[model samples]
Target: MIEALAGPQAGGVDDLTASDLLALARDRKAAEDRAAADLLVVAARWADLHPPESIHDAAAFAVPGCEHEEPIAGQGAPLVAEFCLAELGAVLGVSTTAAKKLVGHALELRHRLPRLWGQVQAGRVPAWRARSVAEVTIHTSPTLTVEAAAFVDAQVAAVAGRVGPAQLDRLVAETIKRFHLADVDPTQDPEDGYLHVDPRHATIHSDDVHYAGTMRLEAELDIADALDLDRALAHGAETLKALGSDASLGVRRSAALGDLARTQTALDLHTQGATGIRDADGLPAAREVVLHAHFDATLDGLTTVFGPTGRMEEGQRLVLLDQLRSWCGDSRTRVTIKPVIDLNADLSTPAYEVPDRIREQVILRDRTCVFPWCTRPARGCDIDHVDEYDHHADAEGRPQPGPTRTSNLAALCRFHHRLKTHTAWRYQMTEPGTFEWTSPHGHHYRRDRHGTTAVDQAEPPCPPDIPRPRRP
Candidate 1:
């Protein structure tokens, strides 16, 4: 069946029987598992080649404070050179962050979870399944001891590494408890056991807004608070119904939350007015939201038969114009319409510090980090000078090599910014909103408004200082 599906003369996929198709799919999946296993082997070898001892002298590339040891790895995992991740990521067409995780998982499995790793090598378990187990063990709270990780490996190997996420989590928890891996506090609350971890959190899923201009909210509040909020929502929903709102109960309840926010803003404003408190502008404080909505010029001038779709810069989601109008029309919401700046025009500052106008231009231009495969929003990122800014250019009376300008600035998340600053990775703004990046391994990639693309595959120059591991 493998020969029929994957060997020479395998082009007749349309003529294949249903059973043949199923067999082909299974064969392809098996091939993928083998490839994944091979990737792990390569990642492990890469880690071995760039061990801590190899890059000890290269202090600039080493992760700060982890010169002798890699802090990202598990207890029993091998230490890898901190700067090695970017080159590997470039070669493998993945993000440096992803490559680091891959190396961490490989080391965790090969050393900390030997049985599972062996099973992966023997093809009895898929590499992904084993890696999943390694991920859990490596990141357990308080950190897993060598013995605890070994216990997890034994349990997983017994099941041929066919553990689901929930089952794997439970296994890690059990192993931690069995080995007493977590630190125990003698004076802590006995009812909470040795673990004093608090799981309560209220999270607003702002990054995952939907196309309908809605966001998901989750919370784990105290029982009394939860009940009180529920009662308030119910009361607000009833009030809306009384005010002739024909929306469904669920929709009204959702709207009630917004009402609650507006109500709180109003109460605060009322108190400020009663107290005769005002800002420099002589106005009471109000809830304000800045929303950037982009509309195409050719789209009927922001009106259509239904309504033009707009892109919200905050969440990078498509939102209806109607929804935006509804939000702006809220009684307590203050909307400030700033004058539109021409994105094509370049803005510059004489000093090294970037002006707010230039920063906003950079954010609006690049929507996210300019690094390859980095999705961190530009608004939260640092506006990095594509060319290194010279602090003493004016003092020295020399030409400013790197001026603070819109064309020279690009947004980079903190980690990638550090990586660009310290590592061999280098990038330049080839054009406005377009950056060309060259990794340590001589691989070139381009990132622009559209996304990242591999631009060059030049032969990597050897770093004479870094030693290569001997192959067996």
Candidate 2:
């Protein structure tokens, strides 16, 4: 076979047949690949158990052994790709995200059809097909057993041919729900060993600046479940008052305790007003001031940011707000200075839609989707003006086109953001309804009235140093 398919580059066969040599090489490579993939699969399972920080640290250690100090030059995507393409997993392995899918399927199957797992491992059915049955069974009925597993598998296979392991697993779970029955309750008296607690929390923001402070209230135990909620609230209020100091009550507590206090405070206010209010401050006046700040800052900040107007300044304000919230505890009393980006509408340019009439007209022209492959109606798109009506790019590439116009805007959903930014897919609207796309391999694919056409051949092989598509 090797001799028959040998190219001019192939050397003349020696004593051994060329086919034998080729076969040997193929087997060796396959074995190596499988070994590598297996190791990666095991590694992925181990990594799931450990912290990502530890995995990162191990990656840092491996870097010293490489010719270059970095395995993937500190890049995340490439590193992930490398791991995925490891010998065993390159053809059969999955990404971390994909692996998580398997884990999720396993958990679903376990919860729905405990007996079906053994059926799957025994090869009676594939993993995904089994999962699907499990999903159907659980949804239809509840208790699953080995007897029901066979029926579930056959029913799922008939509906959906040979499902992937993950899908099969889900099907099995669903099927179990549909056919399995729960066990009957025992005739003997049942013991109640578990405790149920429902906690509530509330923060009182003093309306008056002088008296306002952040006072958290919480109930320690569930009064409804215990039939003593009022007692619990009273006890919590007393504890809070006792804990409060003149300057401020300093409650050095764990996050759990803080949460409990806040919840109890809410219950106190709801059941019996003012029962859970805690003033950590030594003076009630300071507590009032804190409460005032909280109300003014939280409520005022929300109004100032959202109530104002259109999308023009909303994005800018939101960005600044995000940064402010991160750095400052609250937006009260803190002064914020933001460098202005040009958002003024330009009247002269064709792309500029001052009154948004031009915008609607543009949208009408492109009636459907802006993306080359997408045909979704344009009604939901954000009218991004094309011309630099709002943004003025400086010489340093600061100001540029704002997202409006027939030519500049392509209707995109939130999911397509990264698809446009990172993927090989590229699109351009040449005319009102016409579009073009260039694939990652440089294939110019165009769709028109006649049909789709591939205008080019395969792209040249990329160098090792040059990154390739993460996946086909």
Candidate 3:
């Protein structure tokens, strides 16, 4: 019935008047409400998933304004365009083309100014008290709408103070209550840990069968004692496993063990029920833990927890369990690569160590990252082996692994650990404590350091007048 009334068929219903349109309005109103609801749902979903520009496009389709058909048809296209151009030129005091562009800008400010005026009449403020603040505050940036609104409120409060402070406070409170409430900031830890994790690329072969990969999560944790790390790991793993299963519904996972280098002690496999820990009431408490496990499906299921939950007991306990799951659920991790520089082709092992008694000897030398153009500190770098000890043959009968030695070792941070694999770049030992780096284009870079004294340079000659040559 409502559809018929809204459709062209309604023109034949002579008994129907504009008032009867409301009588058939029930179904029409319901349909309109559902349409609006559907629109809002789609708008929210689009905003959550898309960029702002895309959201604007979605909004244009979702909420179109009434068309001015009569004005365009009566005026004729060229005459209407000319009139619009002339009117815009007069308003902006510019050429018609420039005026056309400025039309939207004028309407935008003109539209918002009335809202400011309404707030003033409602005991908010007159234009005199607010325009200066509003101009600076609102026109400052398109992003600071809240700031602009705040400036309006502040200006009103100042003027109201001259009239009556109590009345002004009530007015401010009422405006906030009747209009919009500002979001409160969440309380968090003073030291927040931010991790940027890039997952290693893994391929699933045609059969969806694959064996793979490595530990590569980074965290900022206290190097010294404050929290029980092992327990935390267990709790974290539990949390992550739950998250992987249901991302939106589950808590963040907490474990940190898989990413850090481990010695593989039997303790790595141990699982114990919660026993000693307790809450303030002295009841049995849940413990934090992580245990390793494997799942054969896609690796995209992992969930990461990002913040500290220290004070909320129940939340902390749950978060800790999730963390444990994160650590234990992952069965594999990416391998860490290191770089080594070898001077001798046959020698093996890259460990560089001077005898303890000769400690003073090594320090008088090398100062920084040994790599060409790198300024990394030498103290934090690893002394890497340039070659492997074992020699293996390929199916075609070729020597596989080469030898290694101290002369092959070079200092590198974790970042540049695998950078030496580039085919175009090569480095050679010029002499002890010196290296010459050559680029693909034949460019050269030299890195050198000297000890307190040269080993081969002759010691200062003995006093010429005395027994300088007596021993010889």
Q: Which candidate, 1 or 2, has the higher lDDT?
A: 1
**Candidate 3 overall lDDT versus native:** 0.36
| Number of the top lDDT candidate | 1
Error of 2 at 212 (Å): 68
Using TM-score as the yardstick, the better of models 1 and 2 is 1
What TM-score does structure 1 among the candidates reach?
0.81
What tens digits encode model 1's per-residue C-alpha lDDT throughout 1-472? 4455654466677777899778888888888999999999999999989887776345444345332445556986777777778678877777778899999998899998999999999999999888888887877786888988889889999999988865776676666667877766667655444233334568999877765667999997878989999998999999999999999999999999877765555475575566554445555545555677876656555444457777778767777778767877765566676767688889998988888988888888999988987878899999998888888888999999899988889999987886787656789988889999987677889999888898976756668566433111
lDDT of 3 by residue, 1-472 (tens): 4456655555744666776666666666656545533432332232223223322222343323211111111011111221223222322233333433333222222233334434433543433333333333233222233433454445555554233433433433333333334332246331221111112233323223111222233444454422665555556566666657443322233223432323123222333433453345443332333322222134344333543211111111112334334444544322222232232232333223433222212211234445554445454555543432333344457653432433555564433333333122356555655766543334455667521111132234334234111101
CA displacement after TM-score superposition, residue 394 of candidate 1 (Å): 4.4
Query: What overall lDDT, based on C-alpha atoms, would model 2 receive against the true structure?
Result: 0.39
Please give, for residues 201-310, the per-residue lDDT of candidate 2 as tens digits. 34343222211112344334344744564445445455756666232223323222433433443443454544333344321111112110111223334334323221
Candidates in order, TM-scores: namely: 0.81, 0.30, 0.21
Those runs of model 1 whose alpha carbons end farther than 4 Å from true positions after fitting are 1-11, 56-70, 182-209, 216-232, 257-291, 296-306, 392-397, 466-472
